[model samples]
Target: MIKRILLLITLILQFSFLHAGIVILNGLTHSYTVENGKVYKGKIAIENTGSQPQSIKLFLQDFSYTADGTTHYTALHSHKRSNGDWIKFNTNLVTLKGREKTEVFYEIAIPDHVKDPGSYWSVVIVEPVEDIKPSDNKPGVNITSVIRYAIQIITNYDTEKAKPDLKFESVKVEKEDGKRTARIAIANNGNLYCKPTASLEVYNRTTGAKVGTFSSLTMGLLPSTSKTFYIDISKVPPAQYKATIIATDEDENAFALNVELEVKND
Candidate 1:
């Protein structure tokens, strides 16, 4: 019983560390339906939930997820599929009073020469200008940390949605420091980018009964790219198990892959 309690606590801690930024009220509604060679207008709100005044910087970035599901952002114009050049915001910097909210309006100017007519995206990074290290102070004397929220601006210009083809190549179970995890190799063979949600169910080999389950958060993958979707299985008891992986694509298509996994406790 004590082991189970400790295991639950550890899982809670693991999830808490994944949180960044003060608050992002807009969840998946960041998507916008736009048209080519036209101007699309949209508004977003950013609030200062803290007790004091806060400074916010709004900018665009082209983002991608790594094999381990870590988000990496590049300058908006640096990427080949960037829509950064088309985005124009009311203000890049804003100061808000305590418990105050402000709305930022933006315009997307779709160029007539847009060759790729599928899905184009940019991350609206809402960064708090708090606790930033001084640039002129020195090299390695002080530490700095910045917490920010990434609001995805997914836009579709084509009449038809770009299809995403995802393939589950394999699952590898590895143990280190008594922690067990499953690394799922995912491949995107389509012409558009996609972020697929995944769930894993573990079944005991001996009794054929369900032992545990884990789910992975969504991560975007560009076309013709491969990434590893990592799932945590450290809380699972030491036993021989088989995992059933269920991945549902953009168009509600489901794919299943089964892999054998063995867990050894610390």
Candidate 2:
């Protein structure tokens, strides 16, 4: 329950730190599929809603996601997970006039020698140009903060080896928003993407008899990323019960998690 509360708080904090004026309308993630050797092109719109012009710079970076659900980014030319090399953009810098919008075009080139099929990605980071100026009547240091937003570009090769792989990291039962909910965190440590169909079957603890079932929200999980889904069990009886959550994907991969939850009358 405490963990659930913390998760809710963290989500609130993330939204509070969003950009004040600039907006990326295409969202933060883009997925693409390229054959053996093909060129995939796309564009995204960036709008400056503020009254003043803003200078922005765009670039790509390599990133890694851990089991803790945090993302760590490295240089564009990192040793592994470096998709920035395959990408070329039409523009690297742009100045958006007040109430102006512009489209940035990008292309992903797949080499002919690339045969291994898997998922690769890079983060398209949009940030303001940093400025440094000497303060006349100030101390030794002047620190200015720059806020950057990352848009993930995921590429997948069309091959059978790019399959969906999922594993359960943890299962949690919590009371959230006056409802009994089961939260399951799963990690996709594979080369593909998947949307798992999640369901829960509640059983009587003493007799082990099947009592009721519940269904949760399902979403797409990308490669090297983790997603936590929730199942609402508000209608279950107020008794000690055992619930088995069964999640299946279009690839026929199944994951089951057993958790104990006690429904309340309040």
Candidate 3:
């Protein structure tokens, strides 16, 4: 009788650990539009839709851009004339009670030299760094939850110039037992033919930091054509994680998207 009771308790513990109380509420934007080579105003809304209050930390990294066929990211107190610049609007820490939400706002400016304008992209990520005590007992522990929202801006240099459009279809991320993998279908939506180069960024969910980058082979994608790529993540550490996939055309215009995943080792 004691042996059966132990087995049942173990099963219940396992099930409780597998299903925790982490929730990601919807994100809101104050404004998302581009004009005169500048993103006028932008805001982010984060909510604690779980059963308990959450202590959260927020960080805003500088914007990145490609210039003269070269890619670069903005640095603190340093501005690149050729690439682009990131303007700091605001950053803060807040405690969100259950079913409550908070807002953050910022502004960005684009240089006039960026003539080949079509679409530019960046990401705003929010993560929960505090560990929550489990309501039930389990042998194992996993505590990292992150949510990210991608920001897109469309720019036009000339009325006659071709307008750029791009899309990703059937994007998916999977983690089973302990292995992780990602797959996506990229498509070109512009009238002009383009050869695209893809860059993938992997991040650690706990620390909200970048882990590594994976670059795919350059492929010639004609208008309205799509291609698929797969990334292997078996060697990555077991944690909550995410990836950003960036595609740049020959003219140096850029488009980006973000995906989230989990790694379980039970």
Candidate 4:
């Protein structure tokens, strides 16, 4: 009887190893940005690179870091396992071919009541479940494999009440095809709606004479919300250029903000 039991155990381990094979090929969407009180569309794409067919499960969970730098994961979907904090949705399963790829899409909405502007990260995990047949005619084996991807979320607040206190938080300039392009972040701290309009003015810093002006279309800024604007500075010669951002509220109250940037010839 003891010999039979040992044989059964060995067979079970062997069968478990042979029955399931799973590998993760790719993960989609590394970063995402959404304005406060806006809806965001998120999707994850995964490919099965294993030899055997398998059923894959997906779930969303929150990862928290403690004061001592310890990390813990809490399930965000309530229907799978009852943990007090539930965000939404439940576990979903899909079958994949030996080398097939699939995509899963979900929507997330950020409430307008969010008070802070910052970054948030979340993970979407894909688990593969497989069944194994025992060689000794004992119970079958079940195997699970998982893959996870990190997502970054940025929230910007733009509302109607904050206009005059708008300021440029940061500006990044990059050259492509001999043209200078800039990505600018404008933040509003006052009360009122402000629309951003920018004009690139080149000046001889010491002479104070405007060399050229390149204006951009106006973009709306809700109170307390930060808006990102893109501008092209290639037209201005290789010199010091002052980007004048003019913000106008619904009532025609306007404010002028300026940032000095340099253009270098390639």
Best by lDDT: 2
In model 2, residue pairs whose N, Cα or C atoms come closer than 3 Å (at least 3 residues apart or on different chains), thus clashing, are: none
User: Which regions in candidate 2 have their CA more than 4 angstroms from the true location?
Assistant: 1-20, 77-79, 130-147, 176-180, 207-212, 234-238, 250-253, 259-266
TM-score of 4: 0.39
How would the candidate models be sorted by TM-score, starting from the highest?
2, 1, 3, 4
In the range 1-266, model 3's lDDT, one tens digit per residue, is 99999999999977754443334344322222344556565566676666566676655433433211233334433422111244444775667777777776667775555555344333344556566555676667665545444332222333246544667665555666655665556777664445577767879867879988766566544344476655656666777788788887776878888877565654
Q: Candidate 4 at residue 143, lDDT?
A: 50
The C-alpha TM-scores of every prediction are 0.69, 0.77, 0.41, 0.39
* Candidate 4 C-alpha lDDT tens digits along 1-266: 99999999999978766655544444332334446566666555666665567787766665433222245566654222111121233337878787777766666666666553333334455667655555665577645544444332222244332234667667767788767876666666654334566555556677777766666667654334476666787776776666565555545666666778777776
| lDDT score of residue 14 within candidate 4 | 80
TM-score of 3: 0.41
Q: How many clashes in each structure?
A: 0, 0, 0, 13
Residue pairs that clash (backbone atoms under 3 angstroms), model 1? none
* Lowest lDDT block of 10, candidate 4: 78-87
Q: Between prediction 1 and prediction 3, which has the larger lDDT?
A: 1
Better of 1 and 2 by lDDT: 2
State how far residue 20 of model 3 sits from its true place (Å): 7.3
